[model samples]
Target: MDLAWVRQHVRQAAAELGFGLVDQTKLVTAASELARNTLVHGGGGQVESTVLQNGLARGLRLTFTDEGPGIPDIERALSDGYTSGGGLGLGLGGARRLVHEFSLDSRPGAGTAVTVICWVAGPPRQRKEMR
Candidate 1:
């Protein structure tokens, strides 16, 4: 997966959801890290974005999935300094910290999927209703 494309897509979604610059940066940064993990560790994956709403709240949700040797130990993977690959081992944990909501599912012989959401506090922008 192209990390740049993932970042851009996340930034666009955040902006559309009325997330400020800080929130946009957070979302993009998290997306970049996850996308990289999806490629290097998960053996490549696809990302999907969605505009979310909860009453007056607005948010952007990003989901990354890959069909590869899934994480053997999810708890260790989410630890701050653990890695299956060569790196600082902060991708999953750091990405989780940057978003309002985060979830992960992995089947050792199947694949892995990570989902994250960043929200804009307060009311949403005045626009057509999201479907």
Candidate 2:
């Protein structure tokens, strides 16, 4: 997967989708982390963006999937400062903090998938009544 393309498309999509300026930055950073994980650890994956309604609220979901050496220990991997190859090890954990919802799936020999959702937080606006 082309990381640059994913980053660019994510930023553009977030803006066009009505995410606030500050929220968009968070989402973009999350996207970058996930993309980097896929490329560096998962041997590359595909990203999908979807628009959905959640209890009258609008949200965006991003799913990243890859077929590569999966996580051996999810709990440890998520623990702060834990790294297999000796690094800062903040990508997955940090990405989770930057969004509304975060989830991960992986198997030792299978692959890994990460899903993140960012909800547009605002008071629900009442729809105009038809005349």
TM, every model: 0.86, 0.83
Compose the digit string of candidate 1's lDDT tens values, residues 1-131: 37777787788777767788888988888888888888888889899888888888888888999998998999988988766666435668888998989999998979999999877877655556789
Residue-level lDDT tens digits of model 2 in 38-113 = 8889888889999867665677899999998999999877777665562335567878889999999999989999
Instruction: List ranges where model 1 is wrong by over 4 Å.
Output: 85-89, 123-131
In terms of TM-score, which candidate is strongest? Answer: 1
Alpha-carbon local distance difference test for all models: 0.83, 0.82
Model 1 CA lDDT for position 8: 79
Can you give the lDDT of residue 37 in candidate 2? Answer: 82
